[model samples]
Target: MSAPHGINPNIPHSARVYDYWLGGKDNFEADRRVAEQTMAAVPGIRESARNNRAFLGRAVRHLSRLGVRQFLDLGTGIPSQGNTHEVAQAEAPESRVVYVDNDPIVMAHARALLTSTPEGRTAYLEADVREPRTILEHPDTLATLDFTQPIALVMVAILMHISDADDPEGLVKAYAQALPAGSYLVLSHLTLDLIDKRTADDYVAATSSQAMHRTPRTGERISRYFDGFDLLEPGLVAVSKWRETPLFPDEPAWMYAGVGRKR
Candidate 1:
């Protein structure tokens, strides 16, 4: 069957808009329009996007330094600079990464752009985060990752798309259960704490065309995902606050990020 309209260039996609926010050129006019609208609603959106990406890098570096050699990055958007494997393998050439996403466009580019060092491996699975079992059971993932070993599960900027109806907490728990005790769960999600309720509601409504769901969650609610895990230092802070450096200080953003290790 032909790809759906949302996957077509004419339709706006959440991933493409996110890509645009990160200053990427893979998005279409439709994507840019919605992205701009979102920005107008949330002025710090671009900073949030950049900060979220930087958080991914920092978390990956920290995980690599801690000797985590495998990664399962779900909701893998269109291939952008400093992707999961790129950052992880840069720190440890022997790192193995499996990226998962439902978007066919992302899958296509991921196949072309997500290359790895000979000493390591990188594979992309065109699957939805809602189907965690299918992703974890995929043969490519099974071949590349040993479930018994520690793996970093990166869910950056993706959970916001999963509506409350989808049971985001349950999904996290399911994925966590599939990993070993030493595994890590790194995630960044959008919240409305910093913005007015009407503004947050408008932002969520603006992206309704793509069926996007944005939940303005509390720190406590976001922490529920890491229920069984031991949270790292500075637990569940805004994306900008998670290990902020002089280059990127803690600032008010609409997103929260954290990394936790399975006990």
Candidate 2:
């Protein structure tokens, strides 16, 4: 079957692979192959994906309860249950959300499924995360979000794609500088901290053929991304342990997650 316009189903996309990990039916064979390979390498990867998603929901809900009604979700993946707008708007009907991603498939799926409440609004931006200014200046972003008010900047499990040379910290700081005080930065990243060198090498070998540009950073480095933000309770920890206590505490931490508000 031919893929949709502007989409090459033959080439695996990170977002689609992620959708496969989340058990969503929006992925193609290429994506499933990579996802399955990753699962084979890191047996706990699928569970870790679910945990990261749960962290997203928890962070958004926490910010909403704290009265943040606007959201700028960068690297917005394939829409599934508990999307940012869905979770935020459910808490406050007047919430406004701007979903941004560079992938055509992600934008298409988001536009079709990430609907907004009549009282709230949702806009999709076909943009890359590396260019924070482009995203902040996009007309769709300006139309959907208020720069003056607090906005939650959500970047989940996407930074690993950014190479170290790209200065991921500087990219994050650019966005942080643009956001108003009181805005929240909700971020989660893949890490190799709690696992052995062999396991990390195995994971890299499994996905290396997929042309994925991933860099799993240390928890300390990931925490530095939150520079000026005041981290909420239970500061940066395994995604499974962020706010939600884990049933299996012995599992190796595959990802680090946290929520912080600009100070």
Candidate 3:
């Protein structure tokens, strides 16, 4: 099959799989197969995905209420309801947001669908997170945000896909170093802590695409990734417990989330 927006329709993209998990139809059979296989291995995975999305909304709203008007959302999956701009602009009409993603499909859909309030602004940048310098140097990001002020760097349920060899920690530190003091790092990542090793390996194996490869980190490691920042209350907790009333009080999202102010 030919690719759309330069995206191979046959390859299972991580973002597409996530979209399917969140009950969106912007995925192909390849994505659905991997999502279902992972779901078969782990129950309530779809619900967990929803819970993660809810956490994103809560985090954005919470930060926006605190007067952080600029946002740089990396690895922003398929544009869905309650997106970062929608959540932030709702809190303040003048909020500015820049969504970045490596996936062409996401960029295509986002360019066509995501828009901001007339008083606010939203822009899309197609770039890899590994190149933090490129993102920080992008003209659109600089134009949309004022570096003198605080901005939120959002990485929801995305960093786990970065391989250890890629030096994920160092990459995060680069982004952190670029932001001014008072800027926040908002992140949610998958973990292997709750599930058994076999299940973790099986889940990783089941999703066989190199582009979709994931390395589930432990909670402690994920916490350490926020080294340059001071965590807020209930730091590095499950996504569902992050500053929001839990929709499903009992089920664990098996993901850790935190919002830390750069020191």
Candidate 3 — worst ten consecutive residues by lDDT sum?
244-253
Worst 10 residues of 1 by lDDT: 244-253
- Please provide, for model 1 over 1-263, each residue's C-alpha lDDT reduced to its tens digit, 9 standing for 90 to 100: 23435567666777888899988888888788888887776667787788888898899999999999999999999888789999888999999999998888888889988999999999889898999889989999999999999999999988888889999999999999999999999998888776677767776776555444556677778889998889999988888777856124434467889999999
Q: What's model 3's lDDT at 148?
A: 88
User: What residue runs in model 2 are displaced by over 4 Å at the alpha carbon?
Assistant: 245-250
Backbone collision count in every prediction? 0, 0, 0
**What are the C-alpha RMSDs, in order, of all predicted structures?**
2.7, 1.6, 2.0
Candidate 1, 140: how far from true, in Å?
Answer: 0.5
Estimate TM-scores for all models. 0.92, 0.95, 0.94
Which tens-of-lDDT digit does each residue in 1-263 have in candidate 2? Answer: 34788787878888888888888988888888888888888868888888888889999999999999999998999998899999999899999999989988789889999989999999999998999989999998899899999989998988888999899999999999989999999999999897888888888788677765778899899999999999998999889888865534527679898989999
lDDT of 1 at 85: 91
Residue 47 error for model 2, in Å? 0.6
- Cα shift from native, residue 236, model 3 (Å): 0.8
Better of 1 and 2 by lDDT: 2
Whose TM-score is higher: candidate 2's or candidate 3's?
A: 2
**Model 3, range 130-239, lDDT digits (tens) per residue?**
99999999999888988988989998988888989999999899988878999999999988676666766666666554456877788989988899899987898888
Candidate rank order under lDDT: 2, 3, 1
- Name the lDDT value of residue 207 in candidate 3: 54
For each candidate in the order shown, give its overall lDDT on alpha carbons.
0.85, 0.88, 0.86
